[model samples]
Target: MTPRAKTPRNSGQRGGHVLRRMRASTVYLLLSIGALVSIAPYLMTLNAAFKPQSTLLSTQAWTPAVPATWSNFTALWSQYDMSGFIVHTAVVAGTITLGQLVFTTFAAYAFARLDFPGREPLFWGFIAMMMVPQIVTLIPLFLIMSHLNLIDTYRALILPYVFGTPYGIFLVRQYFQTIPADLEAAARIDGAGTWTILRRIMIPLSKPILATLATITFVNTWNSLLWPLMATSSERDEVVTVGIAALQGQFASELHILLPAAAVALLPLVAIFLLFQRHIVRSIALTGLK
Candidate 1:
């Protein structure tokens, strides 16, 4: 009988370990570069907001101010109606976010779980609405508002959008479908009705997707410009987006003020993302699995 020789294991193991490390390092490096590229413009905007006019016009506009100045912000809040615009923006965004949450949650639950006449057709019809360019509806919406004498009012600003959006409904409906139907069946066996199942079972389970939808609604409503401009003629009712646009036109020569207003307008969305980033990431991962 002859014995066979075993191959050496050290080189192969060390080479594979080293290869894994190299791949991980490459991934991290690429992600860091991508993050920097995405954030650079925001950094420049915030930096320029604090820079003096002299520095803003210079070639080194991206450089951080030596000692950051608050004059631009002060001027915007005092000389213009920036503060009021911010308040207006917050109210509208908050209202729309809340409305979408309530309406979308119920609507999605029904579409996902309930069986009704024309259910499939109605759901697809809503999907079809998403493809219709929003601008085409603007004229009809305006005419309705005008006839109702709601122009330049908060209702005019909020009414059209406070209803659930097709995207919101779709997002929530898909997420709801991902839930285990067994949970609802068990709850029903224990004397739970539709509302009980929704309030206790579904709502808690849907938090991540709801948070994602809320953040999106708030940001989109805050950033809406065209509808606000067309719906509200009064400066007192102006949103930050519309206000910033007006400032850009009027203060075209004043980069200092314009930059500060623009930077300040971004703070709410940044705060929302920072606070809910975990939920957003988790929901996106869960939804991706769908």
Candidate 2:
């Protein structure tokens, strides 16, 4: 038999595979570097959180919390009102999330599905306000809260956020619009009222977006600092972030304690993001599909 010849196609395929692998490797290398850079501060915070106060000054910056102890965390809970602050923050965040879910969903549904007068204009107005900095309205919010005698109260923390955000309305509205109108029209053909259609058809299909909204709202509210710091004075009203800030003066020399308290405030948001990150991305993808 004549010697078999290797075709150009085989070599081209091999070369393409090689090039693809090289590109993938380069992309992975860059991503790995970026991940490390992003996580470095968090790793350092954990190091300091577990390091003994005496060793913190002596140890190098990159030193691990060798023989790591839970004393800092224990002391944080025992010495400070951390537990109460966490519970209070959770309550505030939960209330705000629930409120946003209700109000934002309703508003989004109306804008998306209804034919009310001024609907488009109102929605565009909401979109326009999103460009305005939160700081610009902070004073007005504070005055409203003060006038309502809500300062230093849970109402102050919850009220400002409970009405839903512009971003939330926009996100949910976009997602709502993506839902097929056929399903809604079919429901109406069966004599379903708007409320029935929204309740049964719309909400059930909206779990992903709602979950995304809830995660974002809860994490943002949990990490909220400036407003809480400004609005709340009493330890009873203060959230963990504010409490952690107050520790700066008291635990200035105690790196372990201060960092651990900070870690407590920081880690919840990090964990929430890590857990619900996929939902967030999925929601965005779905919203942008239309």
Candidate 3:
């Protein structure tokens, strides 16, 4: 029996498949290169963090930290009161994150679920705040804090931001709008109050977006430098960013110490990202879908 002849159609389809595969490979290659480019600085910083001051100047920037020393970390912890700065940063970041979650959830819920006169106008007006840069409000915030005699206190750090940010409110509100009204109606039919429905139904269902918002708030607050620097003068109230900047001043010529201090400041954010990465991705997808 004669074998079947290859047709032009079959050959054309095979060529199309090869072209698609080539395109995909090119895309992947470009993406991988971009990822490496983005991460190169972090890699260099990590290498520098463990190198000695002498080695840092002599070795290439990309060189791995061989025979890594612990002295940089030791000096940071022992001499610089790194523990106190870490604790203060943690306290401020944790408080801001918690406050944003609670306040933003409630505000978003009200905007998303409830009907009132001028509600849309009010929400849009509030969200317009997002268009305003923090620098615009910086001087006023400082003056207010100073007038209230809260400068250098945790209150100065936490109180101003605890009321919920415009971005947080907008994000949660968008997520809340995606939920079906039937859920709330069913809860109401069962005599569940607004607070009960929000606590039991909305909050649980919106955990992914909430986690994303919390992680964002935590990282932003932890890395905050300008506000903390302006508000607090003493070491006792300073956060990790301020502490790291101070390390730069004290060890002006020591890249090894400065890099380690910066790396240490980054650890908590890295841990948080690793823990909540899935939720963050989900939240991003949800936002895009909405």
Candidate 4:
């Protein structure tokens, strides 16, 4: 009967459809604005990196009347030891990422698939620990490092990563749950041990999430300032973030130098994200599904 009434041209239905589309368009516009707002700082950094010191510090619009100079980059590379900082950051990030992934994966597999007394309680304890702020453990961790005589060494940094991260274990455990038990069962039926099953079956299926986690861990460690600052005082042990902050302190007046140094510190992460963006997106989706 309502459809029959619509024989009068269905203007109301058409109007409703038009209104829905308009609402959708408005939502898209709002989202676009939000995205632009989020991206503005990075855009400004990029532009300022290319600009001269006077222009960078000035309150002019993003684009200047005159062409930008490459002297900023040259000065930063020569004076700030940016290349050395990059290598240091890469080493720290790589070591931490590998340590976290391996230990976390094993711990996650044990918690998820293995049977043991008090396993559930231990896993829950780990979950509870995640609720505790990292600040609470900083003093204790420092004391432990101090006692071991590992201060200012790579061991001071790498030892903390060897035990596995609560976040990493939690993330991997959630992913492991999504994996079919049938695969594990088949491997076991074929006399494959737990290690074999995990390495051959579970790990292979979890490439996306693993890649994403590795990327995130690398970025985080590379940008870590507080711990690196506390752990290592010498420029020799400096990571990129601490190096950039140090550079900022040294070149206070030279905005051109400072901005370009900051840009250099950010470039590796930006490049990594750009290269692995698709993998990151897929891994995030998979992680969410878990």
Candidate 5:
């Protein structure tokens, strides 16, 4: 009988490494499939953007042979006044994002670090607000807007965020809690006041969360429709979402005008998301929250 060759002891370790790598590869494959599935609709819209009106309204699904049409974009710009819509959207979204960040940051810092009477209760109250359906406050918010004569203005679009969002404060505060007290203590020993520590130390260190919040706020404002529609009855204050909806409603059957307008409305949020995705991941990792 031929002597069997002995397997080396290290062969077991090598086999274990191979098994681990196979598991990792399987995990990556699953994640890739999920990502592609999530992105499919957006990809379809992108393809639709370049296709002609005839192709867009067709019952068929995605088609690679569809020749690109620059006219769809031109029609989008001229028919819908997309540039104006983009500007309006940008103004409202940018203001809300900046305002929310400033107010929420300060509030979050206070909740996380400062001790005072009623602080815990107030924070809990804010958390409770997050549970309440937003629709419950819509009528009240609208009444306030009407009384303030902020109707048909960016002010109406922006006012809600200035008061601060409960979720925003919660996110920042959670992240702030993870930061060691020693950092703030060091700032205090160096003659930094509350505002100074917040501005110089906390804010800089919280860039990841801040960037994430701004991205979310920007997307929310940019895509907002009902509030913009209710607040601004005219195109003068119409953001992209409202503008796109109005264009589709008016055009009805005109894919040439409607589809491209929809595409235009989508591009800004996508661009911003891409730019800040790293910060978004870091924020989620650091905060352990969405």
Candidate 6:
């Protein structure tokens, strides 16, 4: 059979497809370039982490660490007491994450499910707190901590954060609101209380969002510098971010040591993201839909 004639309409359709493909290719090319630009520093840091101070200082920034040594990692672990910093960071980040998850779960459940006087107004007011920059509350928080004589204490780090955050509440609440009311109704028919319904139904169903909130809280708490710096006076109580800064000061000229220390500080966050990335993406999509 003869092939169909190349009609003007078919030609136009083919041309439109070509144009669309070209636009997509251009978009992808730009995105790839942007990704490489963003990742270049981290690549440099990874390379620098393994080199000796002499080599790093002598070589260009982009050069890979030839004959890579574990010395930087060793020094960071031992001389810098990175273990202590890691432990402190873990404690603070873990506690804050747990607290935010628990408290925010309940708060979100309440706002989404329970009937209360002025609930909408209260929730809106709480969300309004998100609009206020955290720096605005720094002075008041410092004064309160000072009044309680909690400065330089773990209480100072953990206590202030454990109550829950506005963003966490909002994210979880949005997810919770998406949950079917029928589930709660069925649970109630089975004599389930608010806490039980939350635990067995809402929390379980909202895993993706909770994971997202937990990951965010953990990363933020772990990377926290300004607050931890002000709250804790001594090196013993400082988190990894502050510890890394102090480590830089001690090894001011040592790129090898500083980069490795920064890399070490980054490991937990990297691991957390790799582990929960699916949930994080799902949560974002879910939140957007809601």
Please name the candidate that would achieve the greatest lDDT relative to the true structure: 1
Separately for all candidates shown, the number of backbone clashes (residues 3 or more apart, or on different chains) is: 0, 0, 0, 0, 0, 0
TM-score-better candidate, 4 vs 6? 6
> What local distance difference test score does each model get?
0.92, 0.88, 0.90, 0.83, 0.86, 0.89
Ten-residue stretch with the least lDDT total in model 6: 281-290
In what order do the candidates fall by lDDT, top score first? 1, 3, 6, 2, 5, 4
Between candidates 2 and 4, which one is better according to TM-score? 2
Model 3, stretches more than 4 Å misplaced?
A: 1-5, 8-10
> What TM-score would every model get versus the actual structure?
0.95, 0.92, 0.94, 0.89, 0.94, 0.91
Residue lDDT tens for model 6, 180-239: 899899999999998898889988889999899999999999988888988988987988
lDDT of 2 by residue, 1-290 (tens): 99998778688889999999999999999999999999898889887888877787899857988878888899888888888888889889889999999999999999999998999999999999899987888899899999988899999998888989999999899899899999999999999999999999999999889989999899889878889988999998888888888888888877777888878887778888888888777877777633
Query: Which is the leading candidate under TM-score?
Result: 1
- Model 6, runs deviating above 4 Å: 1-18
Tens-place lDDT digits, model 5, residues 1-290 = 99998879799899999999999999999999999999888777777778877767674447752578888889877666889989988888888898999999989999999999999999999999899986788889899999999999888988877657999999999999988999999989989999998998899999999999899888988887778888888889888888888887899888777767777788888999999999999988887774
Tell me which of candidates 1 and 6 scores higher on lDDT: 1
Encode model 3's per-residue lDDT on 1-290: one tens digit a residue: 99998778688889999999999999999999999999898878888889887788999989988989888788667767888999999999999999999999999999999999999999999989999998898899999999999999999999989889999999999999899999999999999999999999999999999999999899999989889999999998999888888888888886766788888887888899999999989988877834
TM-score of 5: 0.94
lDDT of 1 by residue, 13-129 (tens): 999999999999999999999999999998889888998777778847677787788888888887788889999999999999999999999999999999999999999999999
lDDT by residue (1-290, candidate 4, tens digit) is 35544354788899999999999999999999999999777777878888766667565536752677898899888776889888888888888989888988899999999999999999999999889977787788889999888888888877776567788888889889999899899889999998899889999988877777788788888878778787888878788888888887888787888778777777888888887788778877876744
Clashing pairs in 1: none
